[model samples]
Target: MELTDNDRSIATFTMLAHAVVHWFELAIPIFLVVWLDAFEVSVAVVGVVVALGYVPFGLGALPAGLLADRYGPKRLVVLCLAGTSVSFVTLAVATSIYAVAASLLCWGILASIYHPAGLALISTGVEDRGTVFAWHGIAGNVGIALGPFATATLLLVLEWRLVAVALAVPGLLATLYGLRLQFDPTAGLEGDSESDTNADGDTGSRAGSAFVSNSRTLFASSFLLVFAVVTFVGLYYRGVLTYLPELLGGLPAMEGIEPPAGLEELSLGDYVYVGLLVAGMAGQYAAGKLTSRVAVARGLVAVFVGLAILAVAFVPVSAMGLAAIVLYCVVLGFSLFAIEPFYQEAVAVYTPPESRGLSYGYTYLGMFGLGSLSIAFGGVLLDRATVGVFFGTLSILALIGAGLSVRLLTGPSPTDTEVPEPTAADD
Candidate 1:
């Protein structure tokens, strides 16, 4: 599809916004080892403290979405960028683990606003949303790859604190750029005002009823089914990614390679990890392209089925020789990230334009908020069960997600139909 100037602008800024937001979010994991030594704390303790930050990242989305509807997406997005920068600067001066926790907490709150705000913007603002969502997902994967890669590289010559402060620079620049960008608040809601009018042709008197109707419409079975599918996807995502490195390191193929000193030590298992995540960029693009041709539900089913197969294969493949291990990482990486755009697209497709922000808000709450529970649950499984058991559970989750996708496929499609504009109060 050909792109217009507005489409290009929205995609460019939103993609950059996605990259920076994820870069800040993922960079924390690289600091885990550093924090362990510096703070002299148990791994479990570090885990709990980090959860403080992550929990809010998920939970805050609902309110952020409400705010986006009331105040506008651009304002919340700019706040997200600037607030993330400040959180990093706070981290740079941390003197204790508590301080680190506090900074991450601050970071999580700010980071929470981006998904609901940014995705809402794209879904409502862009004409070619499927392509835009694909590029947006790729940009997020770039941030995911760059965060750890940059953190690991910078730690070679600088302390973790300094590296964090340095990382904040891009967010500040993005904020400045956002301040100048112009967006039409009603870009995607052109027909909404007329649709919202009552039989008598008055909108103001029925404003309250319109809100109730929209709320009911949002929680209807179709949207709810999609929500359930996305929640399962979130569970699978968090469960697998939380311990991927250790799982890979424990493989027989990775044995006997002497751990390097300093920054090189940080590079351990990273090549495979980064390679898989970087390959996901292609996955995102491919999924985007496929959705333009296929039904969203069919695309979701294919991706989740692929994910389930890969999750089951991961354990056995790592036990094989080096060639098999590389193959495992490549396919696993592609399958892992490829599903994101489909689910994102599903949310936009299933919900009305006026409530698009709210739909994405709840969507991410499941993805991040409820999804954060996987970290703790995964840790418990790892301690009490075998690697096969842990991965098996993830495989089961993926199957559940696939089952949900099948259900969605059989339901009525909600494909970007026009809806009434929200009343002033609804906004």
Candidate 2:
């Protein structure tokens, strides 16, 4: 693969956009504690509220993907970011749990477009897909780390409403800048620039047939297997991350947790939560590179098994004192996201270039859609059962994902047709 101006531009734009997507997505967890107190709701009820937003974040991807295929990624991406910013502004003014739910609903619907639009843009547009995916994952991890850090930091000074408004700022600016970026969405396809759907002039009455046909094409192959893996990944992801910050904040940690002389709201647990996400940058980069070198299923199997162990071990490890907790956080954080690049690569391998957007649609539908239920499930657990039960459940999920990944070992080796090699420029 060769690099071009378009690759650089698209890669840069999508990477930044990916980070912003996660910036908002992950920060919501940080707000959970505050919402629980402010709204005076039970954990189970709050979980349902958050899920209302999250479910659509996944479910909307089907239509968003179709729209991406119909219009183009850039326009939908613009709407996603811009609309999310507006939704967050609404959140800032929210007076009740109902208002917050409405705000999240808007955010979910708008932010939902990103995975399909952005991932499809990169898969079909960037020549060196793996390299860009590495960068993309790294950027998203940064957002995951920073969004919470920013939220926590701001909460120390401003009210939660103000923090919401402040966090919305960068996304709006990113939308403005991304709106001006120009790149060829099909530059990575080399000579085969036109997609089959576009070539056939798919529209209106044919949309239903296109969806059924596209979905069939995906499920007919190993894409179904890839989808299953991602679904499990989503389950673990939402289950753990949704409450991690608040969970960590409650941990009895060492000297680092105490606020400095002037700072009031700072704590070591916040650092631990953020650090775990920061560690994921390394995992994401490594796994993204690994995709070019190894079979994705084998890697996913190893990663999922590791996650199961970590899930079972997390509560015990935190008991050993602050250092052990931090170490656990680092490893847990790294393991949390390591599966992403591989599964992303898997999706690309099992699917075609033409339905790329729809493939990612199903991809996120499994991830965000069904995965949102775990929030409620976890909430119920936290409300009724011990933390031990919660971790044990997470362990089961990881093992199931591992079991699914084991089947992919029978697939053929990589080729130019499967995982695309990283370009020299990427290195």
Candidate 3:
């Protein structure tokens, strides 16, 4: 399906924003290797430092969603990109762990804007929402995979500091480019007549009342179960990526590989880590296609179960041979991202279109904010325990997510069906 000019404009802007967000995000793990040595910190210490950034990145989404409503998705998207650029530049210059932590926190706060703003914009603006969602997820996974690969590649020639500054360039360019593009943010929803947004015109008290009301209404429905699924998936997504390269480094396949001349901070694990996420791009596309065709809850259960089985096999697979390990990485990456579209659509199925911004805001709030613990927790495990324990925990976590999906599938029909649509007078 071809997107019209307006849809293309909006979709392209959101896609760019999504990609840049993950670009800075996943790159941190690659830098974790450098930080571990340069700052002389333990895995737990460094993990906490990075979580300082990610926690806000997730936690701030609710406010970011509100701000996106008061202002606009386009404006917030620009701030997210530009602020993230500055934050990375800050990270590049940091001389202490404290400075690094502060930079990450700043980045998180700004990057937090992307999900609520971007997804809301898409649900409202794009004519072909499902296709755009697929493309958006694929673009994000590209940034996800490329971040580490780009950082690792640049580090081969330049210092990590230079690489950081270099990474900031594309985002800045993207922000500027985003500024000049314009489209009606609600083009797709123009005919719907019923929605929970007065957002741009919302007064302080009215907005708060709406927030409380919406929260009450959403939670009273199946959205709560949807939220639970993401919280668990969030753990799998953040925990695994946070320490994956280091975990891969311990494998026999990653042994005996040396960095190029004068490059002591590089690791062979980074490339394999990137390859796994690159595989996720395919998963993202596939899941996007599946979201509209399948029972979202049922499909998600299968994906999470795949994640559980893969997590259990991760350590054992590395012991088999390089070919087996490579195959495992592909399947694992595929399963990891495959859950995204299914759950994203699940958010829609369980909530109203009016509170789109707030719904997605809370969605990310659970996924990223609460999910940041996985990073800290994984760091602690890697620092204090064995690889088997870490992967075993992730397997258990994925099973928990699978259970949540099962509940969602068998629970009452979508709660969105129960809500009465608000008219203009309700606004």
Candidate 4:
């Protein structure tokens, strides 16, 4: 199937906006310690704050998706991006920890909109959805990689508030530009339609009733399982990445650094540490490509298993160990993103198109809500133990997640049927 001019344009805007919003969304986590140092907060407090931002991602994600269904994915995305931008700018003006905490809540809510709406849009825009989703993952990674460098540079030259405001502006502009994008409403362009059946079809009365009933049934079971998996995924993802800097800082290799003037002060190793994130980007993109060639569940199992092994490998701590950690990180990127396609595809299979946003919202809620706890737990663990111990714990969690992912292989049930055709009625 050929992409219409409109499809290409919407897809381009969607991917670019996704990247920018994600960049700002993820930037804070990588540099949480900087905020704590700059504001005189503790690591535990920072963990709480970091986790709070993610809470809305879980709570607001489904609502955002439902709203997208009611209105349009494109419009919800615009709103989410703009809202996130404004919320982040609030961080610029924060004078106390409470203020920052509040800002994070707002940011989480806004950041939550991307997955369901954006993924649905991409699913609608392209026939080869794996490719679209792959690009989506790549876009997010681009944002993720940019976060550390952007935050680090800004901290060097300006206050964090100024940096946040700068970050907010781009999202605001993207939101406005998105407002003007034209799209096919029935074709998953508008929010409430259940099927892509043509306007001329007289079988609506029969199909609509059955579709609604089936959707409700499918949604219940799928929601529980999806929620469990996504929550675990989010928790693991945010937990690991949020603690990455701290983890690296505490490594035996890093113990050699001369005591710096302040924790906020950059270390020579910080630059090298940033490069590890770059490897994550490479890993994610590579995994995205590989998904089309293999089963996503199998790929996830491989990545997590490797991570578990490597996490344990780091216990010995040597040059080989460091290389193993880097290898683990690279594979982590691949595994993390590889899992997403399966998730998205499952949503497509299990959820009614009308409630797709809701499906995403619930899944994101698990990811963000439960995941936030994981982040805090990571911090607590770090406060109490060594990097090897913390990562080793994460590796075990990864193994558990791998086992749970096996459920995906059973495949989407019949109630999860997606519309086979894209038509004007889809709008």
Q: Backbone clashes per model, in order?
A: 1, 1, 2, 13
Candidate 3 lDDT over residue span 261-366, tens digit each? 7556657776676678778888888887887678889998999989989888888788897778778888888889888888887876676666667778888998
Clashes of 3: 2
lDDT of 2 by residue, 282-312 (tens): 8887787788788888899999999999999
Clashing pairs in 2: 257-268
TM-score of each: 0.88, 0.83, 0.84, 0.76
Winner of 1 and 4 under TM-score: 1
The digit string of per-residue lDDT tens for model 1 on 1-427 reads: 8776778888888998999999988888888889999999989989987887878999999777766655567778889999999999999889999999999999999999999989988877776778888899999988988887788789878988899999999999999998887655345445433333222112232235654665566776488888888898889888888799877777778776765555446434756777788788888888877776888888888988888888788777877887788778888888878888899888877776657677788899989878767888899998999888888888888899988899889877665333544555544
Error of 4 at 325 (Å): 4.0
Query: How good is model 4 by TM-score?
Result: 0.76
Against the correct fold, how does model 2 do in TM-score?
0.83
Every candidate's lDDT: 0.80, 0.81, 0.82, 0.65
Model 4: residues >4 Å from true position, as ranges?
1-7, 27-52, 89-104, 155-162, 185-216, 219-223, 255-264, 317-324, 379-389, 411-427
Ranking 1 against 4 by lDDT, winner = 1
